[model samples]
Target: MKSGIFCLSLDTELMWGRPDLPIWRQRAATVRPNIQKLLKLFTKYNFPATWAIVGQLFLPGDPLWHGPDIIKAIRKTPRQEIGCHTFNHLDFGRCPIQEADEDLKKWLQATQKQEIKPGSFAFPFNHVGHLKLLAKHGFKAYRGPAGHWFAPLGKAGEIIDSLAQITPPAGKPKQANHGLFNFSESQFYVSAWGLRKYIPLSSRVGKAKKGIRRAIAEKRLFHLWFHPINLSDQTGPLLAGLEEIIKFAKQQPGLEINNMEEMTRQLN
Candidate 1:
């Protein structure tokens, strides 16, 4: 039987994650520490993860936004893959091809200075586009959009799924154009902030457990992703919930935890 894969990907964008939302700026201080806590948790579990960081976070300048120190910390962490989240967090689906190309070029230049050559990419806002450019820049894989039928329904569908405690869909990786492997996400791992706070932690953990079971039974990949800032407000409880899910996944036989880069190499 094929080994079931439990893949964790974090969109490690601090202020760059939602520049349009002024509230995220106010919560900036919490992001770095939350990420640090997450790293510790990953260490404790002996699990690897893919951290898709925004390009601007690598450059030196703003203390609130830029975080070369945090970048270094992630690099030093064992089995953690640092993937690109694009420069300026461009919405590739909406942005013009020329603009997307420029953004990717800047991302390559910035990551190069940090001595980081990322083989995996995560589209900003999960808005996928510009595959040829990604291949041109030597990216081997990217986290694609959610494959569920309700994905087109947006946040409403997400809320309903969370409320219903539905088992998220998992699938095998598919080769996209330009030889890039597309790892479709299973779930977003609902944040404990905003209106999402009403979503019981049990629901989140339970859903993840179910997804893991599905993956193991079907020999598919369960790719769970979330932004670090999502845990800023309810840090302890959220982290604990995540730990529960991780522990559950770790206990399962034949379930292999993998970072995005590792998955790409395996699929290749």
Candidate 2:
């Protein structure tokens, strides 16, 4: 690698991102504001962020829900990279392979109507499976779950994950898995809500900075990911923490920041 790479991606699925959780639907009010804040940050930094959206979010809505606006903003943003998160946010690891394949195909066809040929895919809930299906569908890369102790535990993993925002252990980068590029997450931005809210902002920043520093010195890929909803409750603190990390990154020698798709292209 020419320099350490920092990859940032957002699972921008809205209600579909967490269909089972009522909190996702209840927190609907904060979506737009959170998006706007992130957009401003992107503009300020010329940052490229991968938005792995649930395919349903592209459908026309009745104004009460976000659909058209989501599509418009994503399509219009020059620095945003769009990726498929699945049509219904189906869990590929739990659902039948055939069912997941069909969902992927439908998502591909639907998004193509909007002229978005996604080069990347992120499994809904980070439940990775059907890589052959992804490769056949023409996805060049996919984001795996953040590497942590609970990451591989399936359903129980989700609960334990909220308790831990640990960064992945440092190692050599494996550019691809099965057939698609593996741009797995290294750190998850813990939400400033529920139990996680207890984690001091300094601690979150410290962990993220450690990841970035390790990436620069070790010359490895450091990936960070989170949902916009995670910022709904404490947008200011979370964004400020993110800004601190970004500022730290700017000072690092030869470090490059890239969206998931951009990182995949660079690897190839």
Candidate 3:
């Protein structure tokens, strides 16, 4: 078995990721700087990351949006794997599978025009359920909801998985019924952001360190995920904590650090 795997995925949906939340509109302008910060961090660690971008972000000009420029920068960023986060950030669990499938296809066509055929898909809000459609539409892996941190609270597992930083068991990564790999996310870098600044940087860093240690011991994947918007404010401390985890991962022997596509290929 590999020593461990370190996978970082960024859900790069500006306002579309959380359209229901009116507050997100205020943070829409912060998206570019936040993305730049993440890219800088990736460069510092010589790390590769999967950027699951909303297809609409590729379009030019919309309510203080710099879509084309951001897309160009992401494409230029080294070791960055561009992935799709649906055309309109559709919540697969809430919307009919047929509707979601249509959105997924449109996303592919849009990104394909930009020469990006993403091998990985991360459902908007992590409301994932349409696994068969993902495979049929040609995604190698989809980031699944992590196992329950607390009791299985219905669909709460999906939300908690996106917010909570938890360690996973030592086992092979599971594959979805449709034959796509389920790279279940293990942690959220920024637990809470902006007005709801509940989770401190120290706490997040501590949890990340523990997760890293656990992955090393268990020989499992330490998958960390988050949205760029979360880092729009208080970025210094958050990036510092992330750097701590990345630095620690570098010291381990035979540890496999991979993006979503690479991880899927290796596991398959």
Instruction: Give each model a TM-score.
Output: 0.96, 0.90, 0.88
In model 3, the number of clashes is 0
Q: Per-residue lDDT of 11-86 in model 3, one digit per residue for the tens? A: 8888886677887887777888777877787887788899888888888768443376777877787878888788
Better of 1 and 3 by TM-score: 1
Q: Estimate, for each residue in 1-268, the C-alpha lDDT of model 2 and write its tens digit.
A: 7778887888876777655677776666687778888888887887788898888777777432447687677667767998888888888889988998889887887788888896888787678888888888888888876457775675355445433544454434565666677876787777777766767787777777878887888888788888887898778999999988888887788789888778777777
Sort all candidates by TM-score, best to worst.
1, 2, 3
Task: Provide the global lDDT of candidate 1 against the true structure.
Answer: 0.87
List the global CA lDDT of all models: 0.87, 0.77, 0.76
Write the candidate numbers in order of decreasing lDDT: 1, 2, 3
**After aligning candidate 3 to the native by TM-score, how far in Å is the CA of 147 from where it should be?**
2.8
Q: After superposition, how far is residue 251 of candidate 1 from its true place, in Å?
A: 0.6
Question: What is the TM-score of candidate 1?
Answer: 0.96
Candidate 1 residue runs with Cα over 4 Å from true position: none
Q: What are the per-residue Cα lDDT tens digits for candidate 1 across 135-251?
A: 988899999886676678877777779888898988788786899988889988888776788888899898999999999999989999998888877889999999999999989
What's model 2's lDDT at 81? 91
